[model samples]
Target: GIKISDSHDEPELEFFDRVPTVWDDTKVIHGEVGKYITVARRTGSAWFIGTITNDEERKLNIPLDFLTEGQSYLAHIYYDDPNVPTRTKVGIKNIPVTNKSTLEAVLPASGGQAVWLEAQKKFVHPGILHTQADIKRTHKLIDNKTEPAYGSFLLLKEHKCSQPDYRMEGPFRIISRDGEYRHTKSKMEADFSAVYQNALMWTLTGNKAHARKSLEILTAYADSLTMIPETNDAPLLVGLEGLKIIYALEILKYTYPGIKDEDLVPVNRMFTEIFMPVMENFYAARPYTNGNWGSIVTKTYMAAGIYFNNRAMYNKGMDFYLHGHDNGSILHYISGETGQIQESGRDQSHCMLGIGAMATLCEIAWKQGDDLYSALSNRLMKGYEYVAQYNLGYDVLFSVWEDVTGKYCDWKTISDKARGNYMPVFEIAYNHYVRRQGLQMPYTLQVLEKIRPEGFDRDQPAFGSLLFND
Candidate 1:
């Protein structure tokens, strides 16, 4: 079969020059022995697929779902054809596609087809949790007074917008030697979360006040914060706590002219100069902290990375997220295939924090063409299932495990405290792994169904019913 005389080799030989020999990912896609088989492989961002059939001619539909969602790709397909001008009898065509597309896979008897999918431009902002398309979908749903999202919007609309008095003497130094400034820290977090929620409301409703409040709080932080967060309970408490505001800024900076790049100078300084050093010291010094801490810290980097367009910062966060040895890395956070988390023995509520953080982490990474959600054989999904199953009054497999801090150990059973309370965490996870990926998550679906249109859970983006569910 290696025989190729002059003027006989097909264009595939030329195409081979552009294809990589090694692949970053691979999927079986479709196949059957003695009948037909189709496989797809990805080298970097580009994907290549090959299909062949037996003696019988057959047809198959290959879904391009393996491609990153919301991203565009150019697909060049080469298939066996009966009416081709060349000796090889092959036809070639190029078309644009996304994760939403499917291809008509027609194979002649004993023939084959091959395709190459090349990546194209990304969304306006990368690493964002939600895109313009996502907001647009939510807008349409809300306008039509759709069930879940609209009902969720009405529930959210019942709350009054925050009028943060940023002009006060200062949001000065955040401090906690043992327990001091804990209340101040809580108040600060609530204010920023408010700022973020307001900005989100503005995006969904085009409310001027919501947008203005977000900007005003950010401007105040840029001008007022005297020193970085310093605390004894700080690693778990504060490190420039504004995870939500970062997303809010992501929405406003591009579409709204009210906040200018120059206005963000002080704001960026607030993150890099004021917040970054403290955050670096925390994870660097306390790699042995709880998984939830790692989750939030990694999330901070995700926000900063997207906001400043610092791929290095983004990648740095990703490095710890994937390979870090601490309890926070998804590999270590969720144990084995059982999805049992580190804090399972300690308390159910704390376990929810880790799961929520990962949901947001995976969402941000997924939009960036990084599928962290599916990491470790869907380990994060398993973690959610483990927690949700337990919270829904079901027994789960749990083993004695020690945390990174070594403070809580020798626990033999899962803690039953707060077992029945379902947090606002399952919506995004259910929507992604279950609805989008078509995976069955009975416990997760039950939990989400119990709390449809989940509202604010805590210091993170909590309005999944309004922002995530379709």
Candidate 2:
């Protein structure tokens, strides 16, 4: 019989949920008499593979030649992971595979690996981050005011009734020398924050008042902010705050039938007419400021694209996210799987900011049936681990990385400013990799442990414990 219980937590139990009790056929994929053996078994519509090794550890490339050619499978993998804090020391995760796919399994001394490949199926209804199911689950957990979530709910409680910050003051001709137009920008952030907090309250609690207040804030902005001139900071302004407005409106539009298409007339007009020109212009300019700049722009545009059913906009965001020339693209941002991000040598705050910002985009993309989180062999996961390990007071290998602007840290080391003070960034990443994807995120979990019951963030995503803890 399998071991009864362990402290491995989420990944441990999730492995049990999919282990097949019976199979149709079995075949040896590879073997070395007393040293190790790898076997594959087929069930009704799925395939499972198990491999074990003697006391000596080994690295093996297991070719999935047995799978039907030209067909796709979602492989749930369980393997030995010393970092997994459990008696069994097993790790688990999911990855897409085909007959031509090859899995690289790293086995420890007397350790093994397992994989369960099943045919692809339809996914859940795509929403920003909190889908209908996600919202329902959050509400169910809130009924008891669950520990960490309870903590987060209490925090949200303080701001759920935030008065809408519509810039009723005239002379709204905003100007910024170098993103320093704080007065109007602060109001913009506050107004969007009100919408988000109120929408979140309505989601967790069955309070129509909260919903109305959220919509009221959005409608107010629609009425007042007519023209968004391409002030120097217009792109930066929308890139940063548009996500909040889009996320809030998504909740309201899905939950409240009161929102008519015409109600969005002014909002859509403003975004398309003036907002889009500058945002698109920013990417076209290829300023290559930092990973966060392009990343935030990609996120805002993607959110708007999916929300408005604008495929061109969605394509643009996805294009930039995957292969933009800027530092924010997946390839450019991650720096060749060392998990050293594009902004690693810059400073800890900016490094974590870029990480969390990209994590936000990946989360959104994941819900929509794309797997950017696990793309490039879990490159984002590696980045999370690298950042967490450094911030948790450990030394990591560093290499000279230069940006498009030919800039490098002359000190030849990662910046130490605000090192240990972690942002509420890792919780979403931890939940996605460990809980949803069944992969071990040891360092990310550590960060979350240090800062559990994650607080809220005004611009970037926060409230991780409440929003993502499963």
Each model's C-alpha lDDT? 0.74, 0.74
lDDT of 1 by residue, 1-470 (tens): 65545433344443465578788988999888889999999998899998999999999999998899877776778888777545776776667788999998888889989898878634347237877778888899899888777877876666544333323223545533246555566566666666677777777888777777778777887787766446655655442354765777787786566777887777777767766776678767855577888887788777777777765566667657765657887756788558899889888888988888888888888777777777656788899989998998988888887666676667789999888777777888888998789998999888877888777655557767877774
* Decoy 1 TM-score against native: 0.72
Pairs clashing within candidate 2: 92-438
Q: Which number leads on TM-score? A: 1
RMSD of each: 13.9, 11.4
lDDT of 1 at 465: 82
Q: What CA RMSD would candidate 1 show?
A: 13.9
> After superposition, which runs of candidate 1 have C-alpha atoms over 4 Å from their true positions?
1-127, 161-170, 173-178, 237-240
The TM-score that candidate 2 achieves is 0.70
RMSD to native, candidate 2: 11.4
lDDT tens digits, residues 1-470, model 2? 65555332333444455667887988899989999999999887788888999999899989998888777787778886776444666665666789999998888888888888877544333388778988888887788888888787777777533433323232244423244455576556666777777778777786777777777766666666655556666766777767877877788777876678677676667667656777878877944477777888888888887778665566567657764666887767775537897787878887888888888988888777777786556778899999999999989888868675455435377878889888888888888888888999888888888888888777576888888877
